[model samples]
Structures are given as C-alpha cells and as structure tokens.
Target: MTLTRPETAATPPETDAAPPPRPEYPRPDRDRSERWVNLNGRWDFEADGHEGPITVPFAWESEASGVHRTWLERGVYRRTVTAPADWAGSRVVLSFGAVHHRAVVRVDGALVGEHVGGYESFEFDVTEALTPGVSAELEVSVTAPADKRAIPHGKQRSIPRDDYDGVSFTPTSGIWQTVWLEARGRTYARSVALRGDSLTGIDIAVDLAGDAPEGAEVTATVLGTGETAALTADGSGHATGRIELAEPLLWSPERPHLYRVEVRTGDDRVVAATGLRHFETRGEELHLNGERIYLRGVLDQGYWPDTGLTAPDAASLLRELELARGLGYNLVRKHLKFEEPLWLHEADRTGMLVWAEPAAPSRFSPEAAAAFEAQLPAMVERDGNHPSIVIWGLYNEEWGLDWDIPGSAARAEAAVHAYERLRELDDTRPIVENSGWSHVRTDLVDWHYYEPKLAVWKDFVARLAAGERDDFPVRLAPDFVVDKSLYGSAEVPRSGIPIVNSEYGEGFTSLERAWHLRWETQELRRHDRYAGYVYTEFADVEHEAAGLLDTWRRPKDWGGARPADVNADTVLVLDLVPLAAGADIEPPTGPLALDVHVSHHGRDSVSGAVHAAWLPAGTPVGVPVPKPEVSSGPVTAEPFRLSSAATITVPPPSGPARLLLWLADESGRVLARSFLDAAEVEPPNRRGARPGEFEDAPAPGHAWQPIAFDDS
Candidate 1:
C-alpha cells in the first residue's frame, strides 16, 4: 500500500542528546549487551489531522501516552536517531516490540518493511537505509480499524454502547509496545528455542541470520554451573544440540529454580533463562514434574487503569505477578491478549504457571480464521522457551466462531483446525482448543459456569465431579437451546480427561463476591475428580466488578475474610450448604450438624482438627472473626472423605449470625476457614406484616413484646 506524507508530519524534537536509559530490556529471553538502544522516551505523533508529542511505548488511547483520546483510524510517529559511534561496520536493525493491527516502517521516507500482526515482534535490516554515525529519520505508520470482526481484538470494544458490553473494554490503537534498534553481526542468531526437560535435559536450537556459513561453531554454556553444549551449523544455517546436567534441579511452584544460559556463535551472543520441568496430564490429573498438582489459577487480563495494555512501568509487571502469588495462586490464565514478554518473563522468574492465548476475532470467516491462525506460530515461538507456560489456550468461549460451535459444522471444523495448528507449532504444552466450552479437541475437559444460587451450584459441582453429567447448560445464540453440551459427540469422549472449572464466579457486592470465592473454591477442592479452577479475574477492569481487587489493585472489603484463607493448599471443605446471598430463612431451632472434610494438596498427608465457632452478625467488620468454640480431636485427613466433625447447639439469635469453621494442624496454625451467614428472619406471626408496618411497631394484630435470645 502506497501512502502520501500527511501535511501534519510530526517534526523532530530540538535536541541532539541521547535518550534517557530505557526500561528493562524489552526481550529478557534474548539479551544482547551494549549493542542496542532503546527508543522509548518520546516521539512526535500525528493522527487524524492533529499533531503532538506522544510517548513511545504507550497506546494512544491510554493516559500514559499523553494523547489520551478515543479510537483513531490511523497514527504516524516520527523520530530521528544516530547510530552509536562505536558501532562502525555492523548491520543496524530497527526492531518494534509490537504495533497494533498493522505497521509500516520507513527510514527517511524510504519504506523499510511492514508487519501485520500486532502481538509479534518484528524487525528490519536498516543498514542499507543509513550510514554509520549519521542521523536517520525513522517513521512508522499504523492503521487500527475499529471493526473487530476483521481482526483479532480481544475484549476491546469496537463501538461501545450505553448498555452492558459484556467483557469488552477500551480499545487500544497505534504503537502499544516498545520500539528499539540493535546492532548484529554479519551472522547472528535469528531465533533461539530452548526446551528444558527434567528427564532429558535442555534441548537447544538456533536459527542463524544474515550471511551464515556452514560448519559455524555454536556453543551454549549454562551460567554458574559451567556446563556447556556444542553444536555445528549445517548448510541450512540451523544448529541443534542438548545440554545434560549431572543433577537436575526440577522447577516447580513450590521450589522455582531457573538456569541461566548464554549461547554464542562468532560475535553473536544471547542470554536466556529456563527451568527444567515437565507438565502433563496423567488420567484426570495434572502432573508437574511427575507429581500431581492442583492448579490454583486467577484470570489476569493484563490491563491497567492508566496504561491500557502497556504496563505503566517495568515494576508494575513484576508487582502484579507478585500480588497474585501472594494470594496463594500458582497459575495465572492470561486471558485473551498475547501479554507482553516482560510479563511472561516475570512469570518465569517468580514461578507462576501461565495459560497464554492470543486475541480472538469477533466473527468467523476465512479471513478472520486466517488472521487468528497467523498469531499461533509466532505466539508459540516467542513464548515456548518459558517453562512457566504449561498450557496453550485458543478461542475463549467460542468467540470468533459465531458463538455457535455445537450446531455449525464449519465452525466446529475451524475450532478443530485452530487446535491442530497450535499443536503443530508446539507439542510440548497442553492445548485447550476452546477454553471455556465447545471442546471439539483438547487435552483437558474444562468448562465455565456461573451461578449465584448456592444450592444449585453445589448440586452441579457434585454431579459433574461424580461423572453423572458431562455438560453444563450454555446458550450461544438467541434461538439456540441452553441445554446443549459443549463436548463433542461420540467422536470425543470425556472419560479420563482432567475436568476443570476454568471460569466461574458471580456476585455484585464485595461481601457477596467473597462469599462466592470461598464457596466456589471449596467446592472445587472437595472433588478429587476435578483438577483445577481459575477464578473469573484477578482485578476489576472498567465495567467488570467480579474481581478480587478493585480497578486500583486494592483488595475489596471481604467482610473480615481474606482470599488467602480459602486459597490455601490445604482447605477444609464443609458439607453445610448455606443459603444464597440476601436470602433469609427461619433459623434452626435445634443443634446444627455439618459434615467436614479435608482437601489437602500438599506433599504429605495432614492430620488436623476441625473447629467450629459462631460470631455475632453485628461484630465489627474489620475485627478478626474466627475464634473456635468446639474442636473435633485430631483426625487423619483423607481426600473426599466426609465425617460429622462438628455438632453445636445454640439458642437462635435475635438477629443474623455467622457460623465460622476452620481447620488447624497440631501446631494450631489455621490452614483454611469458611463461614456461613444466617440471615435474620421475622417471627412466624410477623411474616404476614406489610413491609412498612413493621418499621416502627409490630403488626397491627400482634403485641409489641420483646423475645429473649442469646447474643453469644
């Protein structure tokens, strides 16, 4: 596509000095020294006849970009830079971490190259476009159409309406990732793929670039350990070898150990970090390094209030991972967006497992399918080296499939094709064909279910775990039936596959939301057939309020309850089903019996005592609430084994109350806690009173007599 220079071309700033030190290197997996420059400070920006200065890495719609506005059809950025004086003969390359939709690069008005995918990194050899130590004008033109059906725009609303827009959020336009320049040797490593296996060691593959000759010597040295592996390049410029460790330190969420390696060939050297670990499914269970693991995951949208998709700073990326880990989550499902490499790097460093997927197109078409498929190879190639990523997800909730995969054969085929395409790209990780539902093919049988009624949710969880039902009710289109199963027919049986509640949670209030979090997590843990679960979200985004934290990343008031309490590795699962939120019923007149079970995922069996207590409903909100009143003597915990651990008789309270239950080890350390709210109910005769009649006095026919009740 040819383009004429706009009259509002952004002019260069009046400065000859070098830019400030850039944020941490954009690509942590492949690091090169002193030979690169970060172009992230400022650039003259123009779009839709308006000209101004915009930040380099932030999207135009974000507050951090200084050009915070609505969506734009097109945007142009211009800057001038001079190659470092020290680099005399090496080839200079202009690299863009990523650009939205489509981007065209130019040096001094001469077109250098172009890239279409927005999430993949690309570069151009700019040596021919400039001379050493000379100033060169760099220009990038970007076009981001608002039609999401034609492109992969995950959760980015195209035309926001006044009503609910589901999970859609603000749209991001123009350059949203880092831009930089690097110098490479005549024969440098183009790409490096490292596959570290605890059983087989680390497999290394290097693809050479530029004028690479045959028989080039390639060496990979594991830093600190002094272990090295060597390989020779063939006529095709590809070298492959394996590095075996004498005693491998396997990587796990409990003990995350990483191995830093530096690979060299001639003058080209890149440093990468990987851990020796293996993730697989062994008959209805997820195994990490040969040990079964229960995935405690939270859905992370990778967005910020002010920065949009681009994190405000490097520290923000690490902070989010740390926050999730602190909440007792070992895995984060990076929903939709192909998150920045820096975020993935943090996951690797902090020992958090990641389920990564690319953005999905809103509609199904040949062009849309191709656009979606185009991102898979690059996604796997760019992120396959990270051992933290255990699963590759595609097309969440049947998006881009017209939201009708069960009835349409063509859409089903498309979903299957996408699954096969991703598997072909990288077979090392488990691939979820359609993450939420309509699983034509997948390594795990996962579903997304949301129900606020405690009784219904409880029954469904029990039936699904006991293998009584394989599908949940889901409605894709207006006329479609809601009873259809997302699972494929006889072709794909659900037996022997790990079942997971990938997405499930619903509540409008913070207290209600926390109630759901505690109950839902408890239900999942109570079933041994279930492998894992991912809460709806980590933090609240624009319109979605079902998050553990608010938009500002502050923990919501969970009414004296902490998420870590229910998210612990060992949890006490109670059989008492509480009433739904805001629903009141007559309080029990006799002793309340509850069956308690321990769900422990630790390395060894745990022996703990089940404790029960009651707290006045009017207790101060922020005070510590759990104080045990009755303890069931030490009992050996067994998975899914229910026993009547507690029975307490108390006088019905005059007002609402809370029943608190907890599991404590021999040392008295509280491992998990759960609470049941007993809402206040009116007297038998007062139930017939009009809503307003009881405000100031008793019903018209009843006397205003006070009944005595225990407060404790």
Candidate 2:
C-alpha cells in the first residue's frame, strides 16, 4: 500500500443552522453512518389535485419545488419521522435518493417497500415500521406518468415524441432525490464492492446484512494506509478480499488519486471511494492508466433551472464539476441521466471522466424491456465504485429501440442484450452499445453527427476518420435504416474500437455556437482517428438552446470564443474551411496561405511556435487579440499531422476580419487556438442570429446579446 493525503475534515464553527436541504451525503460511496437522517426538508405534499408544502428535493415541476405545477399524475408524501432518541434496536433505514417513475413506501400505514426505477437507489427496512421511541407515519407514493411507455424516462417529456420533438425536457415529477434516515446494525454491511487495481491491489466485496454470522469478520481498511484486508462471512452472506497495493497512485484525467476505504463487518461500517485506473481499448486508442487518453466530452443535460432533477444545492454538484473542468472537459457524457451519486462523488473528487447512462424507455415493450432492464443492475450496483466511470451508456439514439435498430431483429437483439447485460454486470467500464447509431455490439465506435454544414461536417468527419465511412445518414424514424452492416449483430471493426464523436454541435448563434464549437473542435483534432468529441451541450435545458452554459449556469458568448480555446489538449489544426455560412477566409486577393497542423494529445513531443493574429471582423469571441500577423517559425508537435506543413502567410484583410491561430509553447505558453472568419461576400451583418440574438443589436426581449462579427 502507498496512499497519502486523506485527512482534511476540520471546518465546523459558524452556526445559525438553516442550511441542510440536500446537504450532501446522499450516498457518498456508501458512507455508512453518523446515524444518518437528512430526509431533505419540509414535506407533506400532494399533486394533481394540488395541496400544501412540497420541497423535499425539488421536482414538483422545479422552481425549487414550491410546486411549479404542470402535469402531475400522482404524488402524496406525508412526513412525521422520529427514531433518534439514543439507543433503539437499529435497522431503521428508509433511504430514497431518487424517485421519479414510481415509488410506494409507507411506514405506519403498513406496506413497507416499493421502487420502480427513475434512476436507481432505494431503501426500506424501516425497522418494523418504527416504535421503540414512538412517532411514525412516513408514507410516500409517487407515479410520474404521462405514459412514457413502461418508463425509464430520460429526457422526460409528457407527450411529445414526433421522434423526441424538439429534444424533450421538463417532467421530473415526484420526489426527485435525497430523503434519508439510515441507522443499520442488526447484521449490516449489505454491499461494498470496491475494485481498484493499477497493477495488483484493492478488490474487496462484502454484502452481508441481518443475520450474517457463519465466519463473520470481513475487514478492509486502507484509509490512511496501514493497509488491511481479511475476509470470511460465508454461509450465504458472502465476503471476499484483496488489498495488495505496491505502488498504487494511478487515476488520471491528469491525477485524480483517491483511496479511502474502510469496510468492516458484524456491527457494520461502510465508507468507500476508490481509484487506480486501467480504462482499456488499446488497438484504436483510449488507454488511461496505461496512458493514451483523449476524450474531451461534454453533453451533461443534468438540468436545473431551479432543481428539476434535484441539485440546486450541495455546492451545485461541485459547481457542475467545476464547470466541466473549466470548459476543457475531460469527459462528462451523463446525458441520459442517472447522475447524482453526488454527481459521481464530484467525479471522484474532480479528476472528472464519466459517461454513465440509464433512463431510456420511450416505447418498445416487454414492459419497456423490463423497465430498461431494471436500470442496468441498479446502475452497476450503484455506480460500481466510481473511478469516475469510464463509460457504460447503453441505448441512446435508438431510444427504446423503437427507432428501430435497423429494422428490428427484435431491436437488434435488444441492443445486444444491453451489451451483454452490462458486460455481465461491471466488467469495469466501456459499454456504449447503441449510443448514437445502429451499433449492435459495442465498446465504443460511437457517433451522433449533427452536421450543421461546415462543408458537410468536414466531409462527414473526413470519411469517418479515413476508414472510409462506417454509416451515417441518420433519419431516426421514418422507415429506419441506419445499417451498421445491416443492423449490427457484432462487427464494429473500423480497425477495432475507439471511434467516438458522441454528439456534435449545431448553431443558433452564440457566434454561431462559437462557430460550430471552433469548427467541430478543429475537426475532432483533425482526426488521429478521433477517440473523442462530445460537445452538443452542458446547460441550456428547458428546450435545448444548445448550451455552452445558459440556463443560469451563465457563460455563453463565445463570440470571443474561449472554451478553453478550443478545448486544449494541445490543438491548432487549421486548414481554414468555413462555409456553414460564415466564411473563414475569402476576401484574400493577396497573401493568405494557411495550412497549419498539430493536434498533439500530449505526453511529450510539443515544440510549438505557429502564431498568426488579425482580429477585426467584430472581434469579441473571447476578446484578447493583438500581436503576430504571421509566424510558423518553429513548430514541431506531431500526433495527428505537423510532421511538416506550417505555411501561415497573412496580409489580405482590408474589410471583414478575425483570424487568430495560436500554438506558442516553449515558454511562450499558448498551446492551441484557432478562429478564422475573413470575408468579402456574405456579411449583411452576419445574418442567422435568433436564439438569443445579437449581431449588432437586440438583447432585451429575447435576451442574450454579445455580438461583434460585423464587417457591414
């Protein structure tokens, strides 16, 4: 074992109380107790017929749940509680942390348990419905129905589905999340799991609960690292062990570390949190602990104009993972929502990298494939001990497979049996089977083009990154025929694995969605056979305004462009091809050559120089632009081009302008930038504006305004 730094817990002085509405711990990796009890705040609600108090975790149609009303269906809730008077028989339980599609519960009214997915987590025991210290009556009863075909309900919707009409939203119904009461004891420790392993260590299992006696023991430890392991409990309650650790430290997205274990047995214990790494796929890229890596990812859609899927607190889920790692995103596909294990424990304390999925069911039944295969083993047994989940996804663009996975051979064998039942429940990440297209089996060959032109999305992403197109015409449902080799039974071979485009972006204007997110992230880092590209969102939810923030999370005015300057991992790829209606270089009747390169996924090799600035055609996309008007002088960095090719030139910009192009490094520091625009033709003040409007004026009634690009 070799773990360090895991102590920090001191701040607790100020007190006028009143700050516990979602006050964290909705299960921070199984946290087992200080005898829990949050149960959020104020309850006794009702629905559809309307009634009093409601905020116990938002979702009464949001607006922080003061009952924002829209379409309720069924609700209830009640309250009462009590059980804290010191020593009582134990077990109490209760839990919840998620309840959207259906619940039930009831303590002093009888019926004890019920759960039906909406996104995992559920508990009950309720210690024989309370008594030892009096007071009971809990109740619950939710519903959330407007008919979502057997229920998984991701993008919510109540009645819209002319193929996800305007990409559905609103309808989180009933208690959205958080509601506690824990306690434990009678025999405890029902589930622990762990895993780790950066070359041999941490494996533990546990699972006991209520009568676990035969050999009992269990153990685990590791916390500050005295390293412990031991196991035993087997006459059915199960146990298992491991711990090794020689060197350990490896979790990445650039150092995320984490260890803190704990476990115990008999009287129970809990506390988890892991990390060692090893995300796979070497043949076509994406490695992780073994290194390679490159998945900028974004698509979050967790939603919250005032807490719809709960989370307007707990530091806004670590400020939306520090604003998607300050916009350079190192993964976060959480799209079809299962989110909130406190946002995967803040993406395992901010090293961020998660793909996760759950919530599909729209139509296609056997009770919607058993409510979407009962939420994939309760979301891999409640987030299979997060190492910031490296991807599990399962069915997206095919919704409930009604979108027809290539004319339905039983919906492509139910998407390859939900990717072999989540690779037999946790084969440690990588699943994606049916993410953005018709891929029958998958370990990532991802796709989801949006194609808002840019010369036909860079010639369909350079012919699907040179393996010469592996399907893409996308219709979604009219007769459905996407054909992954005619419905995919298993054959994603584009040189075997790692393709990913996950979802591209379109525009409506934030400078044309920051110029199609800087030319589709510089044509997916000018293709080194891709391996990543998630864009299409990260905010703007009630009616998808194609966010880069905006739905109160703010940041949106890339007309000064700065999504970490084209999501840096070292970038610059400029062959300047513009025309999805903007012109990146045309008025050039003189010097204007171009041809630069340098994708560089960094691990070394990066000399850097390539400058070039111009800025004028309304300069504003992230401001700051002055110096250089040409330089390529010392460029080196090769991973996906740039073994030669620098060219650069400049001059001809008498009217419409804005060129920029950086690279720097070798102490000058820039490391990637690109913005073109020029022009002599189509600039009647840069047309198309609408969503939040603003090429020159109009920000008050439609409200978004941050214009500039005007050569008029």
Please report how far candidate 1 places residue 148 from its true position, in Å: 2.0
lDDT of 2 by residue, 90-129 (tens): 6777788788878898887899888887778878777777
Model 1 ranges off by over 4 Å = 1-22, 159-165, 198-200, 475-481, 582-590, 616-627, 639-656, 681-712
lDDT (Cα) of model 2: 0.74
Clashing residue pairs, candidate 1?
none
Estimate TM-scores for all models. Answer: 0.89, 0.39
Residue-level lDDT of model 1, residues 1-712, one tens digit each, is 0011222112222244844323568888677756888888788999996799888787888876778877687999999988886677777888887788799999999999999987777888888896778898999999888766658888777763211135678888888888888887777787888888645588988888776647788999999888999989999889999999988888877777878888888887788888888999988888989888889899988777766777766765678888898777889999888887888887887789998989888778889889999998788778888999999999887778876788888888888999999988887888888877778888988888776556667777888888777666543322233553548545666678888888877666877777778787888887788889998779888777777887667778776566776777777777667555532334556566666777878777778787777677634322253666777767666543333344433445455677677777788777667666677543447767778564323111000111111224
